[model samples]
Target: MMDLMEESRPDTPLALRGGTRSGDHEKITVNLGFVDLGHVDLLVSEGVYANRSDFIRTAIRNQIERHADITRQSVARNPIEVGLRRYGRAELESARAAGTRLDIRVLGLAVIADDVPADLASAAIASIEVLGSLQASPAVKRVLADRLL
Candidate 1:
């Protein structure tokens, strides 16, 4: 599984998937006003927060927690998976055999296994709406690009 931990670059043909600890984190940059930055700095200096990043993370977590019920309701209504979801070759083949295509909706990482071919992916997947990230071969991504939301 260590071999699947390769980081993805925009220039690379490969995409990322879940395997290592770092796969759980998707780095994001935040912009803040000077006053807010100073406030965060003061909190850090006062030992209320370890750092700006920590403070931001905590704030984000708190907001998410506060809106947990709403999030749950939305997820339930949309039929979306909240975490890591992988669609493998066998699963797609089975769906194809059943004459059913999947409309994948995920709030987190959605992985199409590396072994899944572009044609199979295109045939088996009707549409994809992912709120976070998607992991698939470049070919599969291209074939499904028109169906992605």
Candidate 2:
């Protein structure tokens, strides 16, 4: 089974710690048809749901739960890191020293530390394919733009 356990990184700032905090939420914009919006509003008005967001969240959660088996099978089939993956300067430096480049594949959050220089990151990282989010300095992102998927 995939570990649904929460993880913590002592060096990472709370705000940047994705997959490690239950209270953290990623803002997403969705365009809904008028009919759908009206239905959501009606449910909220009847107190079936607290609000539009709440209703949407609940619906999404239900769908995800319903497809949990598919998600687990996919995760198991892929050779990808499942949760938070943080790469610091020291780790990158070591990879560089060994002449090994990293192909980062993450399903949740991938973070290249702020202190990592653009050149250093480029030297150590071969490619990045993140299913969720990637946090890194602007310079590093710019330098590695071609290598991102």
Best by lDDT: 1
lDDT of each: 0.80, 0.77
Kindly report which residue pairs in candidate 2 clash with one another. none
Q: Estimate each model's TM-score.
A: 0.79, 0.78
lDDT string, candidate 2, 54-96, tens digits: 7777898899899999989988897789888999999999999
User: Compared with the true structure, what per-residue lDDT tens digits does model 1 show for residues 35-55?
Assistant: 666787799899998766677
Error of 1 at 84 (Å): 1.0
lDDT of model 1 at position 34: 52
